[model samples]
Target: MRYTLRQIEYFIATAETGSITLASERVNISQPSISTAIAHLEQELDTQLFVRRHAQGLTLTPAGKALLVEAKRLVEHAQQLYEVASEANDKIRGQLTLGCMVTLAPMIMPELSHAFTSAFPSTKVMQVVGDHDTLLQKLASAEIDVAITYDLHVPEGFDFVPLASLPPHVLVGEIHPFARLSAVTVKDIASEPLLLLDLPISREYFLAIFMQEGLTPHIAARSPHQDILRTMVANGYGYTLANVRPRSDTAMDGRKVVRVRLAGDHRPMVIGLVSPKERRKSRLIELFENHCRNRISDAYIPGMVAPVMEKRIRLD
Candidate 1:
Protein backbone atom coordinates (compact mmCIF):
# COMPACT_ATOMS: atom_id res chain seq x y z
CA MET A 1 0.00 0.00 0.00
CA ARG A 2 2.08 2.89 -1.31
CA TYR A 3 0.24 6.19 -0.81
CA THR A 4 1.95 9.28 -2.20
CA LEU A 5 2.04 12.66 -0.44
CA ARG A 6 0.00 14.16 -3.26
CA GLN A 7 -2.76 11.57 -2.64
CA ILE A 8 -2.79 12.44 1.05
CA GLU A 9 -3.00 16.16 0.23
CA TYR A 10 -5.98 15.58 -2.05
CA PHE A 11 -7.68 13.45 0.58
CA ILE A 12 -7.15 16.05 3.28
CA ALA A 13 -8.36 18.85 1.05
CA THR A 14 -11.53 16.94 0.16
CA ALA A 15 -12.14 15.98 3.78
CA GLU A 16 -11.82 19.59 4.90
CA THR A 17 -13.92 21.23 2.18
CA GLY A 18 -16.27 18.21 1.82
CA SER A 19 -16.34 18.71 -1.95
CA ILE A 20 -14.01 17.80 -4.80
CA THR A 21 -14.79 21.04 -6.61
CA LEU A 22 -13.87 23.13 -3.58
CA ALA A 23 -10.83 20.96 -2.91
CA SER A 24 -9.74 21.45 -6.50
CA GLU A 25 -10.00 25.23 -6.08
CA ARG A 26 -8.17 25.07 -2.74
CA VAL A 27 -5.22 23.01 -4.04
CA ASN A 28 -5.31 24.61 -7.51
CA ILE A 29 -5.83 21.20 -9.09
CA SER A 30 -8.53 19.89 -11.40
CA GLN A 31 -11.66 18.16 -10.07
CA PRO A 32 -10.86 14.97 -12.03
CA SER A 33 -7.33 14.97 -10.64
CA ILE A 34 -8.55 15.27 -7.08
CA SER A 35 -11.18 12.57 -7.68
CA THR A 36 -8.60 10.21 -9.19
CA ALA A 37 -6.17 10.74 -6.31
CA ILE A 38 -8.91 10.04 -3.77
CA ALA A 39 -9.94 6.92 -5.67
CA HIS A 40 -6.39 5.64 -5.85
CA LEU A 41 -5.86 6.47 -2.17
CA GLU A 42 -9.01 4.60 -1.15
CA GLN A 43 -7.95 1.53 -3.15
CA GLU A 44 -4.40 1.58 -1.72
CA LEU A 45 -5.71 1.79 1.84
CA ASP A 46 -8.56 -0.65 1.11
CA THR A 47 -11.00 1.67 2.83
CA GLN A 48 -13.64 4.00 1.48
CA LEU A 49 -12.64 7.42 2.76
CA PHE A 50 -15.57 9.55 1.63
CA VAL A 51 -19.24 8.84 1.17
CA ARG A 52 -20.46 10.76 -1.88
CA ARG A 53 -23.93 12.24 -1.65
CA HIS A 54 -25.88 13.37 -4.68
CA ALA A 55 -26.01 17.19 -5.00
CA GLN A 56 -24.62 17.66 -1.47
CA GLY A 57 -20.96 16.72 -0.85
CA LEU A 58 -18.58 14.19 0.71
CA THR A 59 -18.67 13.07 4.33
CA LEU A 60 -15.81 11.24 6.00
CA THR A 61 -16.46 7.70 7.08
CA PRO A 62 -15.23 6.43 10.45
CA ALA A 63 -12.27 4.92 8.61
CA GLY A 64 -11.76 8.22 6.82
CA LYS A 65 -11.74 10.10 10.11
CA ALA A 66 -9.06 7.78 11.52
CA LEU A 67 -6.96 7.93 8.35
CA LEU A 68 -7.14 11.73 8.26
CA VAL A 69 -5.21 11.96 11.51
CA GLU A 70 -2.24 10.01 10.13
CA ALA A 71 -2.51 11.51 6.65
CA LYS A 72 -2.23 15.06 7.96
CA ARG A 73 0.76 14.15 10.11
CA LEU A 74 2.51 12.56 7.15
CA VAL A 75 1.83 15.51 4.87
CA GLU A 76 3.06 17.95 7.53
CA HIS A 77 6.28 15.99 7.98
CA ALA A 78 6.83 16.14 4.21
CA GLN A 79 6.41 19.94 4.27
CA GLN A 80 8.81 20.15 7.22
CA LEU A 81 11.42 18.24 5.22
CA TYR A 82 11.37 21.12 2.73
CA GLU A 83 11.77 23.55 5.64
CA VAL A 84 14.68 21.50 7.00
CA ALA A 85 16.42 21.50 3.63
CA SER A 86 16.01 25.28 3.32
CA GLU A 87 17.34 25.82 6.84
CA ALA A 88 20.34 23.55 6.13
CA ASN A 89 21.31 26.07 3.42
CA ASP A 90 20.99 28.92 5.99
CA LYS A 91 17.63 29.99 4.52
CA ILE A 92 14.18 29.99 6.16
CA ARG A 93 11.59 28.97 3.59
CA GLY A 94 8.52 26.74 3.96
CA GLN A 95 4.75 26.67 4.44
CA LEU A 96 3.19 27.22 7.86
CA THR A 97 -0.46 26.65 8.79
CA LEU A 98 -1.19 28.97 11.70
CA GLY A 99 -4.37 28.69 13.75
CA CYS A 100 -5.56 31.45 16.04
CA MET A 101 -8.49 31.94 18.39
CA VAL A 102 -11.41 33.53 16.55
CA THR A 103 -11.58 36.58 18.82
CA LEU A 104 -7.83 37.19 18.60
CA ALA A 105 -7.64 36.69 14.82
CA PRO A 106 -9.08 40.03 13.71
CA MET A 107 -7.10 42.02 16.27
CA ILE A 108 -3.73 40.24 16.09
CA MET A 109 -3.41 38.21 12.87
CA PRO A 110 -2.92 41.14 10.48
CA GLU A 111 0.02 42.55 12.40
CA LEU A 112 1.61 39.21 13.24
CA SER A 113 1.13 38.03 9.65
CA HIS A 114 2.71 41.19 8.33
CA ALA A 115 5.72 40.99 10.65
CA PHE A 116 6.39 37.29 10.05
CA THR A 117 5.88 37.50 6.29
CA SER A 118 8.00 40.63 5.91
CA ALA A 119 10.83 39.10 7.91
CA PHE A 120 10.78 35.84 5.96
CA PRO A 121 9.41 36.47 2.51
CA SER A 122 10.20 32.90 1.49
CA THR A 123 7.95 31.50 4.24
CA LYS A 124 4.25 31.08 3.44
CA VAL A 125 1.91 31.44 6.40
CA MET A 126 -1.67 30.22 6.09
CA GLN A 127 -4.10 31.46 8.72
CA VAL A 128 -6.89 29.34 10.19
CA VAL A 129 -9.24 31.01 12.64
CA GLY A 130 -11.56 29.14 15.02
CA ASP A 131 -12.70 28.83 18.62
CA HIS A 132 -10.42 27.20 21.20
CA ASP A 133 -11.81 23.71 20.66
CA THR A 134 -11.55 23.92 16.89
CA LEU A 135 -8.01 25.24 17.12
CA LEU A 136 -7.02 22.47 19.54
CA GLN A 137 -8.59 19.87 17.27
CA LYS A 138 -6.66 21.25 14.32
CA LEU A 139 -3.44 21.23 16.30
CA ALA A 140 -3.97 17.64 17.42
CA SER A 141 -4.94 16.58 13.91
CA ALA A 142 -1.83 18.25 12.42
CA GLU A 143 -4.00 20.54 10.30
CA ILE A 144 -2.14 23.58 11.65
CA ASP A 145 1.57 23.98 12.41
CA VAL A 146 0.89 25.97 15.59
CA ALA A 147 -1.89 27.83 17.40
CA ILE A 148 -2.08 31.26 19.03
CA THR A 149 -4.76 31.35 21.73
CA TYR A 150 -5.55 31.83 25.40
CA ASP A 151 -4.25 28.99 27.57
CA LEU A 152 -7.83 27.93 28.17
CA HIS A 153 -7.66 24.12 28.21
CA VAL A 154 -4.51 22.85 26.53
CA PRO A 155 -5.04 19.14 26.85
CA GLU A 156 -2.39 16.49 27.62
CA GLY A 157 -0.78 16.15 24.19
CA PHE A 158 -0.07 19.85 23.68
CA ASP A 159 2.63 22.20 25.01
CA PHE A 160 1.65 25.82 25.78
CA VAL A 161 4.18 28.62 25.74
CA PRO A 162 2.84 31.64 27.62
CA LEU A 163 3.27 34.96 25.85
CA ALA A 164 1.40 37.49 28.00
CA SER A 165 -0.84 37.48 31.01
CA LEU A 166 -4.10 39.41 30.54
CA PRO A 167 -6.04 40.02 33.71
CA PRO A 168 -9.80 40.34 33.58
CA HIS A 169 -11.32 43.83 33.29
CA VAL A 170 -14.88 45.09 33.22
CA LEU A 171 -16.12 47.03 30.20
CA VAL A 172 -19.12 49.33 30.43
CA GLY A 173 -20.75 52.08 28.45
CA GLU A 174 -19.37 55.58 29.06
CA ILE A 175 -22.69 56.59 30.61
CA HIS A 176 -22.95 53.50 32.83
CA PRO A 177 -22.51 53.90 36.58
CA PHE A 178 -19.57 51.50 36.78
CA ALA A 179 -17.64 53.61 34.28
CA ARG A 180 -17.05 56.23 36.97
CA LEU A 181 -15.55 53.71 39.38
CA SER A 182 -11.80 53.09 39.51
CA ALA A 183 -12.30 49.40 40.24
CA VAL A 184 -15.35 47.13 40.38
CA THR A 185 -16.18 43.81 41.98
CA VAL A 186 -17.60 40.79 40.24
CA LYS A 187 -20.66 40.99 42.46
CA ASP A 188 -21.25 44.55 41.39
CA ILE A 189 -21.02 43.69 37.70
CA ALA A 190 -23.09 40.54 38.24
CA SER A 191 -25.92 42.60 39.70
CA GLU A 192 -26.30 44.35 36.33
CA PRO A 193 -27.20 42.80 32.99
CA LEU A 194 -24.15 40.91 31.70
CA LEU A 195 -23.21 40.68 28.05
CA LEU A 196 -21.22 37.48 27.77
CA LEU A 197 -18.60 36.62 25.13
CA ASP A 198 -19.89 33.08 24.90
CA LEU A 199 -17.16 31.00 23.31
CA PRO A 200 -16.56 27.46 24.62
CA ILE A 201 -13.86 27.48 27.30
CA SER A 202 -13.87 31.30 27.41
CA ARG A 203 -17.53 31.40 28.43
CA GLU A 204 -16.86 29.09 31.36
CA TYR A 205 -13.87 31.16 32.51
CA PHE A 206 -15.93 34.40 32.63
CA LEU A 207 -18.84 32.75 34.44
CA ALA A 208 -16.48 31.05 36.89
CA ILE A 209 -15.36 34.45 38.14
CA PHE A 210 -18.94 35.13 39.20
CA MET A 211 -19.23 31.65 40.67
CA GLN A 212 -16.18 32.30 42.82
CA GLU A 213 -17.76 35.50 44.06
CA GLY A 214 -20.92 33.50 44.86
CA LEU A 215 -22.97 35.58 42.47
CA THR A 216 -25.08 34.68 39.51
CA PRO A 217 -25.02 37.36 36.85
CA HIS A 218 -28.23 38.78 35.42
CA ILE A 219 -27.75 37.32 31.97
CA ALA A 220 -28.87 39.88 29.42
CA ALA A 221 -27.25 39.15 26.06
CA ARG A 222 -24.75 36.60 24.82
CA SER A 223 -22.73 36.45 21.64
CA PRO A 224 -19.75 34.63 20.20
CA HIS A 225 -18.60 37.91 18.61
CA GLN A 226 -16.34 40.00 20.81
CA ASP A 227 -17.24 43.18 18.92
CA ILE A 228 -20.94 42.49 19.43
CA LEU A 229 -20.39 42.09 23.15
CA ARG A 230 -18.38 45.31 23.22
CA THR A 231 -21.03 47.11 21.20
CA MET A 232 -23.69 45.88 23.61
CA VAL A 233 -21.70 47.19 26.55
CA ALA A 234 -21.15 50.46 24.75
CA ASN A 235 -24.88 50.79 23.98
CA GLY A 236 -25.70 50.44 27.70
CA TYR A 237 -27.40 47.10 27.17
CA GLY A 238 -25.14 45.37 29.70
CA TYR A 239 -21.64 45.22 31.11
CA THR A 240 -19.02 42.74 29.87
CA LEU A 241 -16.16 40.97 31.62
CA ALA A 242 -13.15 40.41 29.40
CA ASN A 243 -9.45 39.77 29.78
CA VAL A 244 -8.42 41.34 26.47
CA ARG A 245 -9.29 44.95 25.57
CA PRO A 246 -9.32 46.59 22.16
CA ARG A 247 -6.93 49.50 21.53
CA SER A 248 -9.86 51.72 20.60
CA ASP A 249 -12.00 52.86 23.51
CA THR A 250 -15.08 53.12 21.30
CA ALA A 251 -17.50 50.65 19.76
CA MET A 252 -18.44 50.16 16.12
CA ASP A 253 -21.31 52.65 16.41
CA GLY A 254 -18.90 55.37 17.64
CA ARG A 255 -20.11 55.12 21.24
CA LYS A 256 -17.36 55.19 23.84
CA VAL A 257 -16.75 52.47 26.43
CA VAL A 258 -14.70 52.34 29.61
CA ARG A 259 -12.44 49.65 31.06
CA VAL A 260 -12.54 49.35 34.84
CA ARG A 261 -10.12 47.13 36.71
CA LEU A 262 -11.71 44.13 38.39
CA ALA A 263 -10.74 44.70 41.97
CA GLY A 264 -9.52 41.38 43.41
CA ASP A 265 -7.49 38.38 42.34
CA HIS A 266 -9.06 37.98 38.95
CA ARG A 267 -7.58 35.05 37.02
CA PRO A 268 -5.40 36.33 34.22
CA MET A 269 -5.81 34.93 30.72
CA VAL A 270 -2.50 33.57 29.41
CA ILE A 271 -2.26 34.26 25.72
CA GLY A 272 0.21 31.80 24.23
CA LEU A 273 1.33 29.45 21.48
CA VAL A 274 0.16 25.82 21.49
CA SER A 275 1.77 23.06 19.48
CA PRO A 276 1.83 19.28 19.61
CA LYS A 277 3.99 18.03 22.45
CA GLU A 278 5.57 15.14 20.55
CA ARG A 279 5.92 16.41 16.98
CA ARG A 280 9.38 17.28 15.65
CA LYS A 281 9.54 21.09 15.56
CA SER A 282 10.32 22.35 12.08
CA ARG A 283 12.57 25.34 11.41
CA LEU A 284 9.62 27.43 10.26
CA ILE A 285 7.63 26.62 13.41
CA GLU A 286 10.62 27.41 15.61
CA LEU A 287 11.22 30.71 13.81
CA PHE A 288 7.56 31.67 14.08
CA GLU A 289 7.49 30.72 17.76
CA ASN A 290 10.57 32.87 18.38
CA HIS A 291 8.86 35.76 16.61
CA CYS A 292 5.86 35.51 18.95
CA ARG A 293 7.93 35.14 22.13
CA ASN A 294 9.95 38.22 21.20
CA ARG A 295 7.03 40.35 20.03
CA ILE A 296 4.09 39.51 22.36
CA SER A 297 4.71 41.00 25.80
CA ASP A 298 2.89 41.95 29.01
CA ALA A 299 2.47 45.60 27.98
CA TYR A 300 2.29 45.43 24.20
CA ILE A 301 0.27 43.79 21.44
CA PRO A 302 -0.77 45.20 18.09
CA GLY A 303 -4.45 45.97 18.63
CA MET A 304 -4.96 45.66 22.38
CA VAL A 305 -4.33 48.12 25.19
CA ALA A 306 -2.48 46.34 27.97
CA PRO A 307 -4.52 46.09 31.14
CA VAL A 308 -3.36 48.58 33.75
CA MET A 309 -2.41 46.51 36.74
CA GLU A 310 -1.57 48.21 40.01
CA LYS A 311 1.37 45.81 40.35
CA ARG A 312 3.25 43.57 37.90
CA ILE A 313 1.51 40.26 38.37
CA ARG A 314 1.17 36.93 36.66
CA LEU A 315 -1.50 34.65 38.08
CA ASP A 316 -0.99 30.95 37.47
Candidate 2:
Protein backbone atom coordinates (compact mmCIF):
# COMPACT_ATOMS: atom_id res chain seq x y z
CA MET A 1 0.00 0.00 0.00
CA ARG A 2 2.89 2.30 0.85
CA TYR A 3 5.10 1.13 -2.05
CA THR A 4 6.74 3.93 -3.99
CA LEU A 5 6.21 4.53 -7.72
CA ARG A 6 9.89 3.80 -8.33
CA GLN A 7 9.49 0.39 -6.74
CA ILE A 8 6.52 -0.38 -8.97
CA GLU A 9 8.40 0.84 -12.05
CA TYR A 10 11.35 -1.36 -11.25
CA PHE A 11 9.01 -4.23 -10.56
CA ILE A 12 7.34 -3.78 -13.96
CA ALA A 13 10.72 -3.60 -15.68
CA THR A 14 11.85 -6.81 -13.99
CA ALA A 15 8.54 -8.49 -14.72
CA GLU A 16 8.69 -7.52 -18.36
CA THR A 17 12.31 -8.54 -18.98
CA GLY A 18 12.20 -11.65 -16.67
CA SER A 19 15.82 -11.14 -15.56
CA ILE A 20 17.34 -8.80 -13.02
CA THR A 21 20.35 -8.05 -15.25
CA LEU A 22 18.09 -7.24 -18.19
CA ALA A 23 15.87 -5.10 -16.04
CA SER A 24 18.92 -3.34 -14.66
CA GLU A 25 20.06 -2.49 -18.19
CA ARG A 26 16.56 -1.44 -19.22
CA VAL A 27 15.95 0.83 -16.20
CA ASN A 28 19.54 2.04 -16.00
CA ILE A 29 19.94 0.78 -12.44
CA SER A 30 22.12 -1.77 -10.74
CA GLN A 31 20.94 -5.38 -10.69
CA PRO A 32 21.02 -5.43 -6.90
CA SER A 33 18.93 -2.27 -6.80
CA ILE A 34 16.25 -3.81 -8.96
CA SER A 35 16.37 -7.01 -6.95
CA THR A 36 15.92 -4.99 -3.78
CA ALA A 37 13.00 -3.11 -5.25
CA ILE A 38 11.34 -6.33 -6.33
CA ALA A 39 11.93 -7.79 -2.88
CA HIS A 40 10.38 -4.69 -1.34
CA LEU A 41 7.40 -4.96 -3.65
CA GLU A 42 6.90 -8.60 -2.77
CA GLN A 43 7.20 -7.87 0.94
CA GLU A 44 4.69 -5.04 0.73
CA LEU A 45 2.22 -7.10 -1.29
CA ASP A 46 2.80 -10.12 1.01
CA THR A 47 3.17 -12.50 -1.95
CA GLN A 48 5.97 -13.93 -4.00
CA LEU A 49 5.63 -12.07 -7.30
CA PHE A 50 8.36 -13.80 -9.31
CA VAL A 51 9.41 -17.42 -9.26
CA ARG A 52 13.18 -17.34 -9.55
CA ARG A 53 14.87 -20.29 -11.18
CA HIS A 54 18.49 -21.45 -10.95
CA ALA A 55 19.55 -20.32 -14.43
CA GLN A 56 16.31 -19.71 -16.31
CA GLY A 57 15.69 -16.19 -15.03
CA LEU A 58 12.25 -15.46 -13.48
CA THR A 59 8.61 -16.10 -14.28
CA LEU A 60 5.58 -14.52 -12.75
CA THR A 61 3.54 -16.78 -10.51
CA PRO A 62 -0.21 -16.75 -11.11
CA ALA A 63 -0.66 -14.21 -8.34
CA GLY A 64 2.31 -12.30 -9.67
CA LYS A 65 0.93 -12.41 -13.21
CA ALA A 66 -2.41 -11.11 -12.00
CA LEU A 67 -0.71 -8.33 -10.06
CA LEU A 68 1.44 -7.39 -13.05
CA VAL A 69 -1.54 -5.93 -14.84
CA GLU A 70 -2.54 -3.90 -11.83
CA ALA A 71 1.05 -2.78 -11.30
CA LYS A 72 1.19 -1.44 -14.83
CA ARG A 73 -2.12 0.29 -14.42
CA LEU A 74 -0.97 1.77 -11.14
CA VAL A 75 2.25 3.07 -12.70
CA GLU A 76 0.39 4.68 -15.58
CA HIS A 77 -2.11 6.24 -13.22
CA ALA A 78 0.74 7.59 -11.13
CA GLN A 79 2.21 9.23 -14.19
CA GLN A 80 -1.12 10.83 -15.04
CA LEU A 81 -1.48 12.02 -11.46
CA TYR A 82 1.94 13.62 -11.63
CA GLU A 83 0.98 15.38 -14.83
CA VAL A 84 -2.30 16.54 -13.28
CA ALA A 85 -0.90 17.63 -9.91
CA SER A 86 0.66 20.64 -8.20
CA GLU A 87 2.77 21.24 -11.32
CA ALA A 88 -0.47 22.38 -13.00
CA ASN A 89 -0.33 25.49 -10.80
CA ASP A 90 1.55 28.06 -12.94
CA LYS A 91 4.97 26.95 -14.11
CA ILE A 92 4.09 23.95 -16.30
CA ARG A 93 6.58 21.27 -15.22
CA GLY A 94 5.78 17.67 -16.18
CA GLN A 95 6.20 15.12 -18.90
CA LEU A 96 3.87 15.19 -21.93
CA THR A 97 3.72 12.39 -24.47
CA LEU A 98 2.86 13.16 -28.11
CA GLY A 99 2.25 10.67 -30.84
CA CYS A 100 2.83 11.60 -34.49
CA MET A 101 2.21 9.72 -37.69
CA VAL A 102 5.39 8.13 -39.04
CA THR A 103 5.51 10.03 -42.32
CA LEU A 104 5.21 13.34 -40.52
CA ALA A 105 7.65 12.43 -37.73
CA PRO A 106 10.74 13.24 -39.73
CA MET A 107 9.45 16.66 -40.73
CA ILE A 108 7.57 17.54 -37.56
CA MET A 109 8.85 16.01 -34.30
CA PRO A 110 12.32 17.54 -33.95
CA GLU A 111 11.19 21.08 -34.52
CA LEU A 112 7.87 20.78 -32.69
CA SER A 113 9.15 18.93 -29.64
CA HIS A 114 12.20 21.17 -29.36
CA ALA A 115 10.15 24.33 -29.66
CA PHE A 116 7.67 23.21 -26.97
CA THR A 117 10.42 22.22 -24.57
CA SER A 118 12.35 25.40 -25.31
CA ALA A 119 9.24 27.49 -24.76
CA PHE A 120 8.53 25.77 -21.46
CA PRO A 121 11.96 24.75 -20.24
CA SER A 122 10.47 23.10 -17.17
CA THR A 123 8.43 20.74 -19.33
CA LYS A 124 9.61 17.70 -21.29
CA VAL A 125 7.88 16.22 -24.32
CA MET A 126 8.40 12.59 -25.24
CA GLN A 127 7.53 11.65 -28.80
CA VAL A 128 6.32 8.34 -30.21
CA VAL A 129 6.15 7.90 -33.97
CA GLY A 130 3.99 5.36 -35.78
CA ASP A 131 1.86 4.90 -38.84
CA HIS A 132 -1.77 5.94 -38.64
CA ASP A 133 -3.07 2.68 -37.22
CA THR A 134 -0.31 2.42 -34.67
CA LEU A 135 -0.87 5.99 -33.56
CA LEU A 136 -4.57 5.25 -33.17
CA GLN A 137 -3.85 2.17 -31.06
CA LYS A 138 -1.38 4.09 -28.89
CA LEU A 139 -3.85 6.90 -28.33
CA ALA A 140 -6.56 4.43 -27.33
CA SER A 141 -4.29 2.70 -24.82
CA ALA A 142 -3.43 6.04 -23.22
CA GLU A 143 0.18 5.40 -24.16
CA ILE A 144 0.27 8.85 -25.76
CA ASP A 145 -1.64 11.84 -24.44
CA VAL A 146 -2.34 13.29 -27.89
CA ALA A 147 -1.48 12.74 -31.52
CA ILE A 148 -0.61 14.79 -34.60
CA THR A 149 -1.96 12.75 -37.45
CA TYR A 150 -4.06 12.99 -40.58
CA ASP A 151 -7.81 12.69 -40.40
CA LEU A 152 -7.61 9.19 -41.87
CA HIS A 153 -10.19 6.68 -40.66
CA VAL A 154 -10.27 8.26 -37.21
CA PRO A 155 -12.80 6.18 -35.31
CA GLU A 156 -15.83 7.29 -33.37
CA GLY A 157 -15.36 8.58 -29.77
CA PHE A 158 -12.08 10.33 -30.65
CA ASP A 159 -11.94 14.06 -31.27
CA PHE A 160 -9.87 15.34 -34.18
CA VAL A 161 -9.13 19.06 -34.36
CA PRO A 162 -7.96 19.92 -37.85
CA LEU A 163 -4.90 22.14 -38.02
CA ALA A 164 -3.74 22.24 -41.63
CA SER A 165 -4.47 20.70 -44.97
CA LEU A 166 -1.65 18.93 -46.89
CA PRO A 167 -2.72 18.25 -50.42
CA PRO A 168 -0.86 15.42 -52.10
CA HIS A 169 1.86 16.49 -54.55
CA VAL A 170 3.96 14.80 -57.18
CA LEU A 171 7.61 14.45 -56.11
CA VAL A 172 10.22 14.34 -58.86
CA GLY A 173 13.93 14.92 -59.34
CA GLU A 174 15.01 18.37 -60.50
CA ILE A 175 15.92 17.13 -63.98
CA HIS A 176 12.69 15.16 -64.42
CA PRO A 177 10.43 16.64 -67.09
CA PHE A 178 7.40 16.66 -64.83
CA ALA A 179 9.24 18.95 -62.43
CA ARG A 180 9.05 21.73 -65.02
CA LEU A 181 5.27 21.61 -65.08
CA SER A 182 3.28 23.69 -62.61
CA ALA A 183 1.02 20.70 -61.99
CA VAL A 184 0.48 17.18 -63.21
CA THR A 185 -2.63 15.09 -63.57
CA VAL A 186 -2.95 11.52 -62.31
CA LYS A 187 -2.93 10.25 -65.89
CA ASP A 188 0.38 11.99 -66.54
CA ILE A 189 2.09 9.69 -64.00
CA ALA A 190 0.00 6.53 -64.26
CA SER A 191 2.52 4.81 -66.54
CA GLU A 192 5.59 6.37 -64.86
CA PRO A 193 7.39 4.28 -62.28
CA LEU A 194 6.18 5.02 -58.75
CA LEU A 195 8.13 5.15 -55.49
CA LEU A 196 5.51 4.11 -52.99
CA LEU A 197 5.64 4.85 -49.28
CA ASP A 198 4.44 1.45 -48.12
CA LEU A 199 3.18 2.36 -44.66
CA PRO A 200 -0.23 1.41 -43.30
CA ILE A 201 -3.16 3.68 -44.22
CA SER A 202 -0.74 5.86 -46.22
CA ARG A 203 -0.28 3.30 -48.97
CA GLU A 204 -4.03 3.06 -49.40
CA TYR A 205 -4.37 6.83 -49.22
CA PHE A 206 -1.91 7.32 -52.09
CA LEU A 207 -3.21 4.45 -54.17
CA ALA A 208 -6.77 5.59 -53.80
CA ILE A 209 -5.93 8.79 -55.66
CA PHE A 210 -5.10 6.70 -58.70
CA MET A 211 -8.04 4.45 -57.99
CA GLN A 212 -10.35 7.41 -58.16
CA GLU A 213 -8.86 8.23 -61.55
CA GLY A 214 -9.41 4.60 -62.64
CA LEU A 215 -5.67 4.10 -63.01
CA THR A 216 -3.13 1.93 -61.30
CA PRO A 217 0.35 3.29 -60.69
CA HIS A 218 3.30 1.30 -61.95
CA ILE A 219 5.10 0.89 -58.66
CA ALA A 220 8.83 0.39 -59.16
CA ALA A 221 10.09 0.96 -55.62
CA ARG A 222 8.72 0.99 -52.10
CA SER A 223 10.06 2.35 -48.82
CA PRO A 224 8.66 3.09 -45.38
CA HIS A 225 11.15 5.80 -44.57
CA GLN A 226 10.35 9.23 -46.00
CA ASP A 227 14.01 10.06 -46.51
CA ILE A 228 14.62 6.81 -48.35
CA LEU A 229 11.64 7.45 -50.63
CA ARG A 230 12.90 10.95 -51.36
CA THR A 231 16.39 9.64 -52.08
CA MET A 232 14.97 7.02 -54.41
CA VAL A 233 12.97 9.63 -56.29
CA ALA A 234 16.02 11.92 -56.50
CA ASN A 235 18.08 9.09 -57.99
CA GLY A 236 15.40 8.58 -60.68
CA TYR A 237 14.22 5.28 -59.33
CA GLY A 238 10.68 6.66 -59.70
CA TYR A 239 8.49 9.56 -58.84
CA THR A 240 6.51 9.51 -55.58
CA LEU A 241 3.25 10.94 -54.25
CA ALA A 242 3.77 12.78 -50.97
CA ASN A 243 1.97 15.27 -48.74
CA VAL A 244 4.40 16.30 -46.00
CA ARG A 245 6.93 18.33 -47.98
CA PRO A 246 10.13 18.59 -45.97
CA ARG A 247 11.71 22.00 -46.04
CA SER A 248 14.74 20.67 -47.89
CA ASP A 249 14.45 19.92 -51.60
CA THR A 250 17.59 17.77 -51.55
CA ALA A 251 17.42 14.11 -50.70
CA MET A 252 19.60 12.43 -48.07
CA ASP A 253 22.29 12.15 -50.75
CA GLY A 254 21.99 15.88 -51.58
CA ARG A 255 20.28 15.55 -54.96
CA LYS A 256 17.69 18.20 -55.63
CA VAL A 257 13.98 17.30 -55.85
CA VAL A 258 10.84 19.08 -56.96
CA ARG A 259 7.23 19.13 -55.81
CA VAL A 260 4.58 19.59 -58.47
CA ARG A 261 1.01 20.04 -57.37
CA LEU A 262 -0.99 16.94 -58.21
CA ALA A 263 -3.60 18.60 -60.36
CA GLY A 264 -7.42 18.32 -60.35
CA ASP A 265 -9.86 18.37 -57.48
CA HIS A 266 -8.15 15.99 -55.10
CA ARG A 267 -8.84 15.41 -51.43
CA PRO A 268 -6.04 16.79 -49.27
CA MET A 269 -4.94 15.18 -46.01
CA VAL A 270 -5.75 17.33 -43.00
CA ILE A 271 -3.30 17.17 -40.09
CA GLY A 272 -4.93 17.40 -36.70
CA LEU A 273 -4.71 16.79 -32.97
CA VAL A 274 -6.45 13.58 -31.91
CA SER A 275 -7.42 12.53 -28.42
CA PRO A 276 -10.18 10.79 -26.48
CA LYS A 277 -13.45 12.63 -26.90
CA GLU A 278 -14.08 13.20 -23.20
CA ARG A 279 -10.63 13.41 -21.66
CA ARG A 280 -10.23 16.57 -19.63
CA LYS A 281 -7.48 18.87 -20.82
CA SER A 282 -4.22 18.89 -18.92
CA ARG A 283 -2.41 22.22 -18.81
CA LEU A 284 0.71 20.70 -20.34
CA ILE A 285 -1.32 19.08 -23.10
CA GLU A 286 -3.30 22.27 -23.67
CA LEU A 287 -0.08 24.26 -23.94
CA PHE A 288 1.37 21.86 -26.49
CA GLU A 289 -1.93 21.79 -28.41
CA ASN A 290 -1.99 25.58 -28.61
CA HIS A 291 1.66 25.51 -29.64
CA CYS A 292 0.79 23.15 -32.52
CA ARG A 293 -2.17 25.33 -33.59
CA ASN A 294 0.17 28.30 -33.75
CA ARG A 295 3.05 26.35 -35.30
CA ILE A 296 1.08 24.54 -38.05
CA SER A 297 -1.45 26.38 -40.13
CA ASP A 298 -3.11 26.97 -43.53
CA ALA A 299 -0.03 28.92 -44.57
CA TYR A 300 2.84 27.37 -42.61
CA ILE A 301 4.18 24.19 -41.02
CA PRO A 302 7.48 23.98 -39.19
CA GLY A 303 10.27 22.23 -41.13
CA MET A 304 7.96 21.82 -44.15
CA VAL A 305 7.41 23.66 -47.40
CA ALA A 306 4.79 26.37 -47.00
CA PRO A 307 1.62 26.13 -49.08
CA VAL A 308 2.37 27.28 -52.61
CA MET A 309 -0.89 29.03 -53.46
CA GLU A 310 0.99 30.98 -56.13
CA LYS A 311 4.35 29.11 -56.07
CA ARG A 312 6.01 31.23 -53.37
CA ILE A 313 6.61 28.30 -51.00
CA ARG A 314 10.07 26.81 -51.52
CA LEU A 315 10.92 23.22 -50.60
CA ASP A 316 14.57 24.29 -50.29
CA lDDT scores, all candidates in order: 0.87, 0.86
Q: What lDDT tens digits, residue by residue, belong to model 1 across residues 104-185?
A: 8888888998899999998878888899999999888677889999987989999999998898888999999988888888
Per-residue lDDT of candidate 2, residues 1-316 (tens digit): 6788898878877887799997887667998999889888888889999899978999999998898889878876776676766465657777787999988887888999999899889888877778999888878867689999999789998999999888899999998999889889999999999999999888999999999999989999888888898988899888999988787789999999998888898888999999988877777888899999999887878778767532564433
Q: Pick the candidate with the highest lDDT.
A: 1
TM-score of each: 0.83, 0.82
Superposed by TM-score, candidate 1 places the C-alpha of residue 288 at a distance from the truth, in angstroms, of: 0.7
Clashing pairs in 2: none
Best by TM-score: 1
